[model samples]
Target: MSENGGRRSQAQRDAITVEIGYALFSGAFAAAVVFGAFAGPALLFELPGGLETLLLRTGLVVAPVLFVARVVSVLLRFRQSPQPSQPGRTSPDS
Candidate 1:
């Protein structure tokens, strides 16, 4: 293949990698929200607090946990995968 064609293919592959990584991360967050929302009541009951508790109680803990996990997974993917030398398809450095 010509250099230009190879470059384009590489760019497409890199873009796909980044997009799939993001999708997985987003799915994790969505799952966390749904899990925390439904399980919040029961889970919160386990916590020692009165009825004054707000949604933040559940979200605060769950959001960070989920976000951290997503970030870590995405980072891992970038680290494990070798990126192609293509323009406009740079993977995250960190």
Candidate 2:
């Protein structure tokens, strides 16, 4: 019996893909909050009462899109990668 405990599966790879997506979302959301609170004034045109509405709104809308973009990039990378295969091996059935 193999140490795999059973047949190996791609569940591990799928789970990692999901985790990366979540991480991207979290990081973008955090960045939005930080920028809106601290750096928004400098990065955006000065507004009334020293507030930058455009930066805040832009962050709220863009964060999720950025998260999706990151996920797409990861999936593309996964597709482009080559899988390791046994050399000089062929099934008897073939």
Task: List TM-score per model, in order.
Answer: 0.41, 0.44
The C-alpha stretches of model 1 lying farther than 4 A from their native spots are: 1-8, 46-94
Each model's C-alpha lDDT? 0.65, 0.62
Model 1 weakest lDDT span, ten residues long = 47-56
For residues 1-94, what per-residue lDDT tens digits would candidate 1 score against the true structure? 2367545576567776886778577857776876678457756566445532555465666766777677777667765786566656866883
> What is the number of backbone collisions in each predicted candidate, taken in the order shown?
0, 0
Q: What digit string (tens of lDDT, one per residue) describes model 2 on residues 10-88? A: 7656656676777677667765665565546646666664356555666667766665666667666755665445447
Give lDDT: candidate 1, residue 22.
88
Evaluated against the true structure, the overall lDDT of model 2 is: 0.62
**Pairs with steric clashes in candidate 2:** none
- Stretches > 4 Å off in candidate 2: 1-51, 86-94
Best-matching candidate per lDDT: 1
